[model samples]
Target chain A: MNETLAGWLQILALVGALALSFRPLGDYLAHVLTCPRHWRVERLVYRVGGVRGDADQPWPAYLRGLLAFSAVSVLFLYAFQRLQNHLLLSVGTKPVAPDLAFNTAASFVTNTNWQSYSGESAMGHLVQMAGLAVQNFVSAAVGIAVVAALIRGFTRKKTDRVGNFWVDLTRIVLRVLLPISFVMAIVLVAGGTIQNFHGIQSITTIAGDHQSITGGPVASQEAIKELGTNGGGFYNANSTHPFENPNPFTNWLEIYLLLVIGFSLPRTFGRMVGDNRQGYAIVAVMGLVWAASVAIVTANELHSVSSSAGHAAGGMMEGKEQRFGIWASALFAVSTTLTSCGAVNSFHDSYTPGGGGMTIFNMMLGEIAPGGTGSGLYGILILAIVTVFVAGLMVGRTPEYLGKKLGAREMKFASLYILTTPGLVLVGAGLAMALPGERAAMLNSGQHGFSEVLYAFTSAANNNGSAFAGLSANTAWYNTALGLVMILGRFLPMVFVLALSGSLARQQPVPVTAGTLPTHRPQFVGLLTGVLLIVVGLTYFPALALGPLAEGLR
Target chain B: MAGSLTRLLRHHLAALRMLLVFTVITGIAYPLVVTGIAQAVFPHQANGSLVKDGGGPVASSLIGQRFNLPSQKGQPSGSPDPKWFQPRPSAAGPAGYDPKSSGASNLGPNNAGLVKAVRDRRTAVAAFDRVPPSSVPPDALTASGSGLDPDISPAYAYEQVNRVAKARSLDPAAVRKLVAEHVQGRTLGFLGQGRVNVIVLNHDLAALKRR
Candidate 1:
């Protein structure tokens, strides 16, 4: 069969799968977050932690609980890595260096999973399972928990309470994440993803060549790594590794897994706010951006234009797997980047200038094209607020969404949330380029080299963990700086989001009036999509022009 | 101030306790449960799908391997041995195809170094296989995503038949037939692309030669 047609069919299949799951999963999430009674296991967890499951906290207290949990998680993961040599399943791997350990800890805790250290060589089996995989479950739960609170802000009126953080956290993990991950992990093992505790083994081939192969609890982690939108790999090759993603079926499934929760979230939003069309409109905008990125990246790879190496090779085959070929790789790249799920079936650095640029551009858009699980819905909703504020200016109407008025206070929080990521991304990239030592870390020279630095900071700030890979980012400087960026980028936006939720919850519902714009219509989707593109384009155009645009044109 | 400090400390303690409890559930119990089932049900696959030669594990059918002449003192990186079908060029680690340090070359398509490498590889592969540079499959010339890619495009595999058959003093038709049998189509007819598993193909070829 023609590869292009096959690629389209795979996309259609993915879209079909996601569409089928949308309503049930979304409503299930809504139910999980708002349900009155806790499960027996959840009750046990709450009791063990001494958390009052029924006590609702105002937004500040909720924020404090979240911050405290995440802080403790970071410290624990760091210590785990630093002391892995003493841990069970250490597999003879040495303790990770201080800076790398801190970076890995923060990266996982933030749900970024931006791996600087090679997993097979640097980490023990124990750390991979206990430390990293644990965060994969909880950090993702944390993201969903935050979005649930924000959704509550829309549902409740004249109330300081969002919800109980402990209840939401426990329920999300025990009810949603764990069950899905268990089934998926078994399926992965059945499809040939390794699940074992064996260390590296020395093997001789038929032709008499020696090789050392690694074995660990890969399938279990692989399931959640994609399911949670956490992209850390058990091997340095990441999803490209045959052990993590063995075949085309596993490859397609991983892409679906990463995107499932993120896309389902809007339906959850629609269900919670008592307006399904509102959810549809948000999802429509996300779907449009995601579809466009997929098309551009796929087309760019097929043609092999703007890259001399591709021109010589007769196709853009560098850093791409044979089984997946161009189409599947392109699909994986776009989906991963669009959702802050940075598991790559192909390396972006070796892609055509246009293709690689689209991956970077996807992250620059704040990854809201059905983004990270809970983060995607909240990110797009925040943009929806900004869009309404802009729409209200032109129409001279009261900008109210779901009966919540977008007043000056709400607008400030939304605007700050929008601006924070770009500020960190640009400043971080700029600092990397300005320093000679950092500048020397680029694996490629010239304009393409500039892109490596830009891609790192963009991936870090958006919590999209995929890299251009040509950038040597394991140094003391990159690790520490990127670590800071990951934490700030992940948490700072949450602060504004939680604060906005608080402010929104405090406002009494303003009645729907003639002056209120009908945000549920297709017009709002178009307007929101336009605002998203224009905002990102304006913010990152100069930097892109210097990097991918220059290299491609040359 | 003292009251606020105490509250903060209390919050930290609670969070730490919760973290420990959750860790045991997700970290310890989750993986162990999955591993138990995986080992019980599909032990062969769960424990790295190792293909054996002479009743001992030789290589994983899933992972690609190097087929080169023994390295001389001057040529630390040995030349490709024509007796065996070579997998795609790898940039996994310092040498290539090192599973422990898996990665790609990560070179931008327009980099001078990459461009030159592609050019040189095309010429070298064409010369070695006794084929025109234009006929060289893209997979033959470019390094794979996982530098340890076990599969190669069917086109590349077919192109190697004549050379392998000649090196082994065997029938080209037999070698071609072997390559044909090894080519795997897309899963369920339309998921990825058609390809050949290099490791498995070569393993069978070694068996064929011995017979």
Candidate 2:
């Protein structure tokens, strides 16, 4: 079969899988979040933690619960990294440095999965499984839990209470994340992903040479790392590592897992709010944006345009596996960046200017085009609110979205949610460019070099953990700055989102009238998609112009 | 104010307790259970997919290995042994194909250094195989994502057949047949690219030499 034909078929299969699962998975999620009776294990967990699973909390209390858990998680993970040398399964690795430990802790807790340390050499088995992988489950659960609260905000009227944070978090982990991860982990192991307690094994080659191979509980981590949209690699090569993603089949499966929950989330939103068409409209917009990105990236890679190295090699093969080639690599890059799952099967820095730029652009769009696990649903919902607000201003009427009126408080929260990430990205990148020491860390010179800095900040602020790996980001400055960006990026938006949910919950839902905008219509979908593109595009245009566009055009 | 502080502490305490409980479930029990099942059902794969010669482990079928002559003192890279098919250029470690530090060159597409490296590799690979520079496949001139990638495109593998045949003093047609046998099509016909597993191919190549 022709490679181009294969690429098209692969895309069709992925979209088909996502479409098939959307209704059942989304409806299941809605059931999980809203159902009153707790599972036996959930009841046990709540009892052990002294949490009242039935008690609904106001938004402030819910926010407090989230913040407290995240804070504790960060501290515990930090301590685990610092004390790994003494821990079981230390396997000859040393304790991580203070700054790196702090950075790793914050990165994982925020669901960023960004890494400043090489996995094989820097981390031991205990830390990888118990510390990092544990956060993969909980942080993703926290994201879904937050979205559930927001959904309750839309569903309930004339009340300040959203939902119980403890209950939501527990149910998501035990019922949703863990069960799927368990099955996928075994499947990954069957496909040759290593799963063991062996440290580094020394072996001889067919030709007389010695090789040292590192081993760990990789399959388990690999499963949730993709399932939860946490793309931190157990190896530095991430998904590119043959053991981590042995064959093309495993590669496709990983991509599907990362995208499954994110794409289906709109259905959950629709079902909970009693409007399935509204969910369809939102998902349609997400699918359109996601498909556009995939097409642009795939075309740029297949042609190898705007890339001198690609031209010299006669194709874009650098930093790409022979098995995956250009098509699979580009697909993975677009999906990973569009969502907050930042695992790379190919190095983006080595991609053609247009291809790499589209990836950075994907992150700049706030990963909302079927974004992260729960983040995508909430991100697009906020944009929907903004779209309705903009439409209201144009038509000289009050805006109501999902029965909730868009007022000053709601609009303020939505605006801040939109502003937080781009602000962090620009300021962070600007600072890095201004400093000579940081500028020296870039491996490539000129415009591509500028892109490296821009890519890092955009990736961090968007909580998308992929990198232009040429940036040498393990430095003290990057570790601290990007770490700060990840935390602020992850939490600040949630603060606004939760506050907005609270405000929406307290409102008496407005009755539908002739002036009310029908948010479930195609008109609204087109308007929302335009708002997403124009808003994100306009904000990041200058930075992009100075970076990928300059290099690409030249 | 004091009451608020107490309440904050109480919230934090709940968080601490929840973290510990969840840690026991997700962090400890979850991984251990997966490991047990993987070890039980797929022990060979679970233990890094090592292939053995006689009783000794030779190499992992999945990991790409270098096929070069022993390095002379002060040489940055070893000379490619003409008797074996060479893998793609790697940027893994100080030396390439180091599994412990798996990574790419990470040089951007337009980077001057990367451009220079590509030119150098094309010339070197063409010279080694006694083929024209244009005939050398892109995979031959570029680095793999994991410097430890074990596979090379079928075109790259077939390109090296003549040189290996001449070096080993074997039938060129026979060597060509061997390369053809090793070419693996995309999984289920439309999933990925066609490629030859370098580690497995070379392992079989050694046996062919013995024959």
Candidate 3:
């Protein structure tokens, strides 16, 4: 088959598969979060934790549950890394350093697996399984929990409570992430992804060369790594590593897994809001942006005038696996960034200037093109709230969204949610540029170097863990700075989400009036998307102009 | 005030206990169960698909290994043996093809350093393959995303067919046929590129007796 046709077919296949799962998976998610009855395992878990299964938390208490669980998770993961030398299956490696430990701990806990140290070497088997993998489950669940609380705000009336945080957390892990990951892991293993507990094995090659082979329980991690949109790799090469993503089949499956939860959450939103089209509207916006970015990126890649035959031969094949080619690689890059999953089958740093710009722009859209696991639904919902507010201002009326009045309190939280990441990214990157110590991590000089700094903060603050990979970011300054950025970027937006939910919950839902903007229509989707693009474009334009935009112009 | 403080403490404790319980289920059980099933089902694949020659394991088919002859008295280590088909260029680690230290060079497109390196690589590969610099596939000139990529594009595989045939005094048609036979299509219809596994193709080449 022709390569471009093949590429388009792959994209079509992806869309077809996602469209198939959109309603079922979304409705299942809504059911999992809202259903009152618990499984035996869940009941036992709640009993062990000394929390009543039926108990609910208002937004404040829900926020408290999230904070407390996350704080302990950080401490545990940090300790796990520090004590890797003492742990069995340390694989002859010593403990991780304090700063990297802090960074990795915060990174995983925030669902941003921004790995500094290479996985196969720096982390032992026990830590990869027990610490990092565990966070993939809970961090994603926590995101789901927060979004569930926000959904509860819409579903309930005259209530202080959103939902039981502990109950939501347990149910999501057991009923949602665990079972899916179990089947997916075995499927990956069947598809030639390696799964073993053995440490690095020394082997002789056919050419009489001594080579040490590294293999681990990669299939297990690879499952959640995509399914939960947690992009940490078992190998340093990430999904590009044939061990983690062996064949084209697994590659497509992995991409599907990355998007399933994020995309389907809109259906969950629609079902909860008593309007499936509202969900469809948001998804339509997400799909348009995602497809457009992928097309732009793929075309730029194939149109690589970088060399004469760059067009006839495949597009800029640098930093891409021949197995994936240009089309799949471009699709994966746009998809990974669109969600918070940072696993790349091809290196983004090696992408053409336009391709690179589109990717960073996707992240700058705050990854709400069906964002991360639970995070995506909430992120877009928050944006929806902001979008309605903007529309209302234009029409000179009070903003009402999903039959709930967006009052001053709700607007304040929405404003804070929208503004937080850009503030963190720009200010953080700006400081890194100005500071002498932090400036040393720039491997590329001039404009590209500035790109590394901007990409780091945009990636970290937005919790998208993919790197330009050009940045030497494991240094004390970069690690600590990014670590701080990851924690605040994640939890602070979360705080606003919960608070906004509570405020919305407190307001008696307004009946739909003729004056109210119909949210499920194309006009509304266009408005929400425009609001998203303009907000991100306006906020990050100068920094972008300095980095990717300038590089492309040159 | 005291009641509230106690309530907060209880909440924190419950949170900790929940984290620990869920950790065992997700962290421990899930991985262990998956690993057990994989081992029971496909032990060979679970242990890194070690391809054997004449009943002895040689190398993993998944990881790319350098096919250079052992270092001569004064020659550097990485000179091609010419008896075997070469895989794609790799910038994996110090002295390349170290599976233990697998990763890309991570050079961005706009970086001058990457441009210079690509230029150098293009010149070198074109010289080796007896082709002009412009004719070399980007996969041939630039490093693969995984430095340990086991396969090369079919175009790259075909480029080296004449040289391999000449070095071994074999028919060019036979080598070309070998490359053609080994070129695998995208899986289950479409997913990745149509790629030639260098190791497996070469293993088949080694089995073909020289003229």
Candidate 4:
């Protein structure tokens, strides 16, 4: 079969699988988040944490709980990294440096998973499983909880209460993420990902040379890393590693896993908002952008063709795994970036300039073309609000969506939420470029080097953790800068989201009328997608032109 | 200060408890359960897919290792041995193909260093394979994302048939037949590309007595 045909077939298969799982999974998520009774494990978790699962809190209290939980999570993860040498299964490596430790803790807790340290050499099995993987589950749960609260803000009226943070957190982790990850992990291990606990063991190669083999609980972590949209790898190779993602089958499964929860959450939103088509409309916007990225990237990769002259043979295949080839690599690149799950089956850095640009563009769109797990649904909804607000301005009517008015107060929050990531990203990139120390962190010179700084900031500030990799980012300069960016980028938008949700929750639903804009319609989907492209496109166009566009054109 | 610290301590305590409980659940129970089920279902695969060679198990068929002549003075290892079908070029670690140091070259397409490296690699690989530079598959010239790609492109595997036949003093047709035999098709019909497992292919070559 033609490689292009095969790529599309695989994509069709992904869409088919996602279609089958979408509604049930989305409905189940809505059920899990809003379910009255807690499961035994959830009850125990809440009890041990000294929180009540049945109770509801106002938005302020909800935000406070979230902040407190995140604050504690950061402190604990930081301390955990520092104490690695003293930990039993650290393989006798010393504690991590203070700066890197802080950065990693911030990364994982924020669901960014921006790994500086190579997993096998720098971290022990204990830290990989207990510290990083645990955060994968919980941090994802936090995103889901925040989204659920925001959804409730739309569904309820005349009440400040959104949902209880503790209840939502425990339930999503216990019922949704944990169970699914368990099955996915088993499936991955069946496909030959290692599940053993043996530390680094020396193996002799066929050449009679000694090679050190690092083994850990890889399958378990690999499952959640994708399922939770956390992209850190057990080995530095990430999903491309044979042990983590052995075959093409597992490769497709990983892309699907990264997308399943994120894409399906639109249906969750629709169900919660009492309109399945509303969810479909939102998903339509996401699916269109996502498919376009995949198409554009795959074509860019394939255009140079398979066989050519010596230097022409480049066909832009520098950092891709051969097993996946160009087509699957392009598909995986688009999928990983479309969500914040930065796991790569092939390195994004080596893609054709056009291909790499699409991946960068995917992140620049706030990853809301079905974004990170819970975050995607909420992010798109906020964008929908803005789209509606802008559309309302043209029509000269006060905008109401899902029956709630988008007044000045709501628009203010939406504007801030939209602006926050770009603000952080551009300023951070500018600051890094200005710093003399920052130039040393770049391994490439000129435009490509400038791109590395831009990509790092874009990845971090969007809470997408995949780096351009050519950037030498483990230093205090990149680490501290990106770490601060990740934290602010993650929480600041979240704050705006919750605040908007609070205001919306207090509004009584406006009755439907002729002028209501009918957000679930096809025209609305078009408007949303247009708003998305224009908003993200204009905001980052100059930076993008300077980086990927410049390179691709050259 | 004391009051706030107490409040903070209480919050910290909840976090500690949260981390501990989740560590037990995620790190311990979750992994244990998955491992148990995986082992019960596919014991060989669950235990790293260690393929048996001769008497004892050799390496995993899924993981590509370097087939190199021993290191010479002042030089690193990972020079490809012409006897074996080489997998993708690995930049995983300091020496390359270090299981403990798995990663890519991480080079962007437009970087001058990358353009030079690709040119250098294409020249070296084409010469080494005794093929026209244009005939060599791109996978042969590029570093895999995970320096541990166990398979090479079907084109890459076919490119090695003549060389392997010459090195083993066998018919080129016979070597080509073996390469054809080992080429695994895309999974479940259409998922990934057609590829050749270099490790398994190399093991079969090791069976042929040297000329």
Candidate 5:
């Protein structure tokens, strides 16, 4: 318990730092997107892009700009990845495989860092440092910026434009994410995380045998990867590696970094909306849900006994770092899965039945247990809207969130955004289960085997890239299927969210009256929580039964 | 109403100016600063927590350790010998438990073939350690989904200690003590069970015997 407590303290410190940093960035983004017309610097940027600073855009124009930016980012990131090997050849390095290129580009843009290739062996220092790491920061910033725009749309009284993409992206990366990541990275280095570019070394082991050790500049990438909720590891072992995590302190630090940015974003959102309690309400609900999942996962993982009675006596110790132990690893696992961050300190496959179940459940919640930067906030917003809708239904009045009436169009957009991923995940998993080629890839059969398929779709659909590491998902079938799912899973919701924002932006802001239910009130919070559970539960119950839950009974 | 709203927008626009200015400074400046600190302070870890030995880099400290073969009659096999530490039963054929190809056997417990395989493994472990079949742990006989497991049950480690200690001509008690030393309690003292690291203990065995 001391270890868990210590880990929480470290996590709290990082969260505190992140919360303080989010304000200036959030306020700045809120300002730029809400009123880009008056800013001289923003005007120059708009002029360069041939965008009219004063012209307010309707839904179509807003959607076009959003898609254009996303498309450009994907193409640029893809080209960057493809050309990296050649670029690094001047530094005496070679290119990564074509398949890996696709996987990596998709991974970063979607905020999922599912690496089919090992970082140390496959990527040169330059690509690792410049290309991949840079995307980790920017991709998350993009998510935050989009969410900021959506928030602006919700708050605007009578506006057609959502916000400026460039400006929002810039402020998010510059003010909010970068500063917190920098301080956190420094603290991590102080805690013994490495940051260099020396070649691999061979050392004589204590056993009088030769062993080779690999090292490189990791702390910089790792900091933002976690802070931004991007889960790609500098090494394949991820947080499990002794060098990456090193000691208990470092273990706590890594997990803290993974969660702080994700946790504090709600607070930042609340501040931007001029209602701190709204942020606290969102945080409270998310934090409680996340905490409950962590507790369940940790307890199950720590206390599970294998079927082989002799092996089951101790807690879940398999595929975990001894230095960090089961509690810290379990906490890290649940937290990472809850957010879109996939940095893992232990193998998810080796987690106890319940632990693994909770992880999948968190992902199934659309990764909105605080979620990815832009996506998580937007996801919560959808839930908030749903909560108001349900409450209004109960009271026999029309629902209103931030004074905007919950209507057919808004609900449809929210419903589609919420439902699309589960549909993709289930259909994808179902296809894999039905196909012999896909089924043949299963390394374990029955419940555990089912878990591999479930985990793949869940990870891909949620854009949370950490895997069970027990499935042979690098196959052509998995690669293609998962890649498609990731692309669709990410963009579908985004498009719908942008649409929702556009629709909401056009609605005239209504004044709050006696009949208006305060969204931050306890009753509304309950409704919101219930809405999230029901929506997720309805979408994933059958799949859950077939995977982790059914597997637990066995 | 329109004029007042315009005035309000203009007032907020001033605040927006400060927001944009601060945003650029905080967003770009902060990440650059963090990356710089991380790069300057911990070069190796900053790059990626990779560990290198005498022959340049071998593998990451964060990844699973793979031990492929039995030591030659006199050559050292390093810690966590495959022979004594119940191998993380592999799903990767030919090259067992490869990190690059992580996976489980995907064989359900109900499969007649899987049952047969497990029984065969039980017999083999029992025969190899000269122990009862009942004494062999399931983790010993079964393959983990990911072949790259670094730790095993204390029972699994203990099951091999007698055989390994006999082979090395070391006292069983000393070997057991070493295993105990390598044992890690569950996280938070209550979250997980006690288990021993197969590789670290085996490495210690080799070192202790050498000295």
Candidate 6:
């Protein structure tokens, strides 16, 4: 309990610091991604690329451009990975295994870095930096661009074009992401996070024995990895690595970095849509939900481990980093689960039954509590729209959100995007459970074991990428199945959302009148929250009952 | 209407072209550039953080190595080597810590089977450490979820200090101090519990014996 109290104080302080820093950072990002002030460096980049930043394409055109960009990106990334082993053979690395390559490619492309292979062993320096790290930035940038486009749909009146995809992508990377990454990388380096290319060093231990130290330019990838909410690590242990996370300060920084960008984006959304209130409302909804979920998950994790059936006389201390304590680790678990980030300091599989259930439930809800960059905001908006629709049905009036009427077209797109991942998750889990080969992979039978498999598919299919890791998902069947899920989970929803954006762009923005439902009000917030839970609950309740809840009872 | 539709399509086609161009540049090109920088800056780490043999490349920095194997062939009669620190108990297969099938035995506390397993494990630890069964740490008897845990609880390490020291004919106090030094405290003085790296400590003990 003492440790828990101290942990909360530390986490609250980190959260407060992050809150203060967010506004300026958010303003800067909004300006960089949307404002058209050209620095000298920007001019040089444009000149070198022979790119003109002048084109203002309409909404349909924007969609086409985004699609084309993504297609080419996929091709280029795939090719780079395929050729990486040969090109990087000078560095003593071979081509990645075809299956692993396929999995890695899909994982990064979809903003899901669900790694079945060790990063340091399987990948070359060039591949890690160019193929994987680059996607970390671009994938997040794409998400931001999509969210920006969606906001344009909400705010625009009698407009066909949302915004230029090229401009938005450029602004997101150059103006917003790059600067923050630069500062954060330096800060991480200062905190003893290694940023070098030196060979692994063999240092004599404090006990007078030699042990090899693994070193890399981790600070560079680490900053974006956290900020983008992508949880792949330079080491297999992810944030648990001493060089990567280093100390308590570094761990706190990583948590803040993961959350700050996500928190600020809603405010950015508000500014973009010309409605600060709307942004605040979204933030309020997201924050409340995130806080409640984190609280429940953390309390369960601590309590479950502490209780320990009285057999373990000590506190909840197994498979945990002692430096971080239970509260910090518990908080980290909820934070990582809430966002799509999968960096873990403690093993979630070791958590008590109830605690583990809360974690799976968070993932099953699609990590929409300040989710991955653009995806979280947009995902929540779908819920918001659904809430408005339900409310409208109750009142016998047409539903509207942020001045846009909830029409059939919007509803269809939102429903499809929202439903796709759960379908993949539930179906994948069902198939895995029913099949003998998959069942044989389970180390533990019944509820807790079932939860592990369910958690993996749910994480992969949602592009959340965190896993129980207890399941033997590195096999050929799992590799293919989970890989496919990651791709479809990410892109299918994105494609639909883009199409929805295009549709919404063509329609005139409806004015808010007496009959309009106020989304920012408390009642609507409750409705929005209920709508999110109901949709997730209905879609995933059966699977949940079979996995975590059942495991808890047993 | 057809003419207007075509015009709209054409307009979007150009936008799509721009979008494709930008996506490729940022998505593909940017990743390549960053990867190149990382490689050039940190070559060893850029390579898969592989830990090599005395001669050259062998295993990885991230993967756990196997230790504490039984000396006999299909004989469940002999005890494990006291000199080598053991990893957390695993239920993977005939032998524990099998990467091919990684997992924990999901046994509830109240289950009779679980109680028997725990009691049996406690008896083994008590014999190994020459201490009361109650003194042995829970982390020692319990199987970690991943089963590939490279670390052990500090108390678990401390409990085994006497046996390891006795086996190697070293000072027990020195060994206990070494274990204490190796113990990593909670994250931020509050995140998780303290633990010791069994592999690292054992390796050190071996080096000390050689010295």
TM-score of chain B of each: 0.96, 0.94, 0.89, 0.88, 0.66, 0.71
Q: TM-score of the candidate numbered 3?
A: 0.97
Task: Give the alpha-carbon lDDT of every model.
Answer: 0.92, 0.92, 0.87, 0.85, 0.68, 0.69
Over A1-554, each residue of candidate 5 has an lDDT whose tens digit, in order, gives 45556555544554566567556554554554455345465456444444444655565655555555545545555666667756632233456556667767777767888877766566666566655676687678778767876777777767777775556655566555666677767777766667655555555433334444555666667778888899888777676654456556666667766766667677667876778788778877787788788768766764563323213322344455545556677778888898899888777875666777788899988887788877788888888988888888888998898878889999999888877988898899899999988887876777777888889888998899988766788776787778778888887887888888888888898889999999787776677788889888988898888877776776
lDDT of 5 at B142: 55
Model 1 steric clash pairs: none
lDDT per residue as tens, model 2, B1-211: 9999998999899998999888888889999999999999999999988989999888999998878787667553577889889988898887688899999998998888889988998899989998999998999989999999899988889889989888888888888888899999998899989999989888888878522
Residue pairs clashing in model 2 are: none
Worst 10 residues of 3 chain A by lDDT: A305-314
After the best TM-score superposition of candidate 2, give how far the Cα of residue A342 lies from its true spot, in angstroms: 0.6
TM-score of each: 0.99, 0.99, 0.97, 0.97, 0.78, 0.81
- The list of candidate 2 runs beyond 4 A from truth reads B73-77, B209-211
Candidate 6, residues A227-310, lDDT tens digits: the string is 888888766556765556655677888888887777888778778777677777777877887788778867775565323442
lDDT of 2 at A314: 96
Per residue, candidate 6 scores C-alpha lDDT tens digits across B1-211 of 9998996566455544443444455434544454465556545444434444466543333323345534456543234677766656765334664433333454532234555666788788788779998887766776654344556777788888878888778888888878888887765555445678665676566667521
The positional error of residue A488 in candidate 3, measured at the CA in angstroms, is 0.2
Best-to-worst order by DockQ is 1, 2, 3, 4, 6, 5
Candidate 3: C-alpha lDDT = 0.87
Model 3: residue A139 alpha-carbon error in angstroms: 0.5
Model 2 TM:
0.99
List, for all models, the DockQ compared with the true complex. Answer: 0.88, 0.86, 0.66, 0.60, 0.13, 0.15
What TM-score quantifies how close candidate 5 is to the native fold? 0.78
Model 4 sits at a Cα RMSD from the real structure of 2.0
| Clash pairs (backbone) in predicted model 3 | A323-B193
Provide the clashing-pair count of each candidate structure. Answer: 0, 0, 1, 0, 72, 36
Any runs in candidate 4 off by more than 4 Å, and if so which? A305-311, B1-8, B54-57, B73-78, B209-211
Tens-digit lDDT string for candidate 1 (A205-289): 7678788978999999999999999999999999999999998999999999999999999998999999999899988998999
Which one wins by TM-score: 3 or 6?
Answer: 3
Candidate 4 per-residue lDDT, tens place, B19-120, comes to 678788987788888778877887787777876666655677877888877778846556777777877778877777888778888776655666676677
Tens-digit per-residue lDDT, B1-211, candidate 5: 9998885555444333432333344433444565576666655555544444455544444333545344678654433443455554655333454443444444432334555666677777788788988887656665543445556667787888888777677788988888888877654444334567655565556566622
